[model samples]
Target: MLATTHPQSGMVATSRIHRVVTGNGGAAPSRGDTVELTVSHLTKRYGETLALSDASVTFKPGIHTILGENGSGKSTMLKILSGVVSPSEGTIALNGRAISPRTPHDMHELGLSTVFQEVLIAPHRTVVENIFLGYDGPLRRRIEKSARAPLAQALLAEISRFPIPLSAPAGELPLASQQLIVLARALVRLPSILLLDEATAALDYADRDLVFDAIENYAAAGNIVIFISHRLEEVRRLSDRVTVLRSGHIVETLERDGITAERLLKLMAPEAAIHA
Candidate 1:
């Protein structure tokens, strides 16, 4: 995947920093982390089906949307990125480092967090507890409940449009708010890389608005977010660059200004689209 570079992005080398590498290279360079992620020639197969075929892409400090139809390998790519599934062929690098994560835990350690379409959250736990389930994994807690409560509240304030009671059971929340909670939990630790795989699919109009707000706030913190969705309108509004995939291969990546619904719809479903 070709790495994208921006003036606000690149390695921040200071007194303690010895090496730095910028995102000017086609293949992400190793050293300073101008590029947050790099994927090359990724391929995956399930039985006789080719889930991904020679696909590649990169991640920078902004929002990027992966546009595709059902079974277009968007989820497969996300699994590979989150380390839930292994690519048959490819290499993914982060922060000038290459990794092959065999499980989600590996990604967590890399400061990469994801909220899948299917919720992995515990239903019976309170909202705050659910949000901080793995807080100990990322950082040591000095005062478990006190430290976590305030942090979760602050994160919810930033990401959630409505104030949900922290002590409420997770199962009692509506599905839309639950989805937001999942996303909020992912962002609570301030991960450098975040992935949302069809997260807003189950949301209503109002819920989608809430989700978009969190996504924008997440990106504003100098982090990279991978938004995999079929909604063209949302993708257009949220993505900095749009990456289109068909039959498991990358078709093109259009800059936000260089795109429109007609153009994107055509690229997304060329034969079925009726152009003006």
Candidate 2:
């Protein structure tokens, strides 16, 4: 268990991570956990404006990218999946179980974690605290308390390129580190479905590559990663399947071998491509 000192309450809180220990001294079962998410006829409306139409798609174990221009319903789709808002009409099924998550916490409990474009962190909190924030789950097969710090440290090392002290205040860190901390928070849960909405915008070339490598490994290990980014190059390099949305509707979904800069631009913005 990692002990976190709350600045406001002055109380020490204990944090726990999910793990399954076996006779071979094996750790949590991360890889080979097959997952599938299916969205059918999902729609969202804000008064008279339809933010998302009747959109439908399925995601398996791998990095699936959502592409679209501004107001193309990409954000709305993610919002619905993350339970930021309720869908006006639709059904979401995970592993063949129908679910309607009413809040982000609800979604988190259902094995879905999201790292939005916004950097969410308690500025005055320590790195360790922020990484394991809101960690409330079933204490089944919990690891030894003494081993928690090293686990947190290992997760940070996997995502961040630099050495961030566990005791350092999160607000004192740079934007890149802050973003990484948010990413670490999401990954700490070992979610079955990880949503990244422009999560790498704050990272530079090298740091982005490191995080990308981690994401690829996570997906390759039989987990689903929903990646949303406007950067074409990043999508080209990271996406195994690309879903294009335009005007609140899904335009197309292209496989890895079918993606191209020109084709993507045309699908995302045909008018802009014509003018150019």
Candidate 3:
């Protein structure tokens, strides 16, 4: 009970705390040591509808916001990231290895995960079933249903900061809650990279904030997060870096310090930088 007791130690013991310091006081994420995914010169085109064009980006361990208006090809970029669709031209690297995902199944095998704008959970199934919907006789090699619910709960707990009712039907939940469900499902794979395509469009301000907060955490854990959002204000607030896409081409990539709502809008404006 002395003043200098170790149990209630003063600044001396507290000062010995183990703080995780980056290479330079965490000023920037250490890309060389911590990058999870790399995308270079990616282009996607479907029968003359150019979705992306020569887009090159490196996703470090941080949340990156893709800023674009509708039809700006942001969704195309997300789809490419998740391997939901093939790119006309580009290279993607996961875990420092190059991979060009030609199919959704291929990307999943490579640890590239995503949640699209639309929710696709089975309406009649329970949350547990929804989580394990794909893990059946084919994928899991006879994984029993009895063992799936607890496993789903564990997976949910890994990424979710709050308690989710495992018994509820995912389709019955509100839009925001269902969005969370999709996010949780993607995280179940414990992927090295994550892609979000307008996942927060239906969310209110508070719910959007909650999801973005989770995104920050996910990125901090050394996972790459590629997010596309049409909400310019949210783009500025949530993204560590912003990539502006206009008509399938990356107009610019701005750091958090360099981007603003006015600047972003001006860059996206029809009168700002357009070639007819």
Best TM-score goes to which candidate?
A: 2
Q: Using Cα atoms with residue i matched to residue i, what is each candidate's TM-score against the true structure?
A: 0.84, 0.87, 0.76
Question: Model 2, 11-55: lDDT tens per residue?
Answer: 543222233112212144333335789999999999999989999
Tens-place lDDT digits, model 1, residues 179-244: 878876776555667899888887778767866876775564456889988777888899998888
Q: Write the per-residue lDDT of candidate 3 for residues 13-32, one digit (tens) a residue.
A: 10010011111121111223
In candidate 1, position 263 carries an lDDT of 80
**Whole-model lDDT per candidate:** 0.73, 0.82, 0.67
Ranked candidates, highest TM-score first: 2, 1, 3
- Top model by lDDT, which number? 2
Give stretches of model 1 more than 4 Å off.
Answer: 1-35, 138-143, 274-276
Better of 2 and 3 by TM-score: 2
List the pairs of residues colliding in candidate 1: 21-32
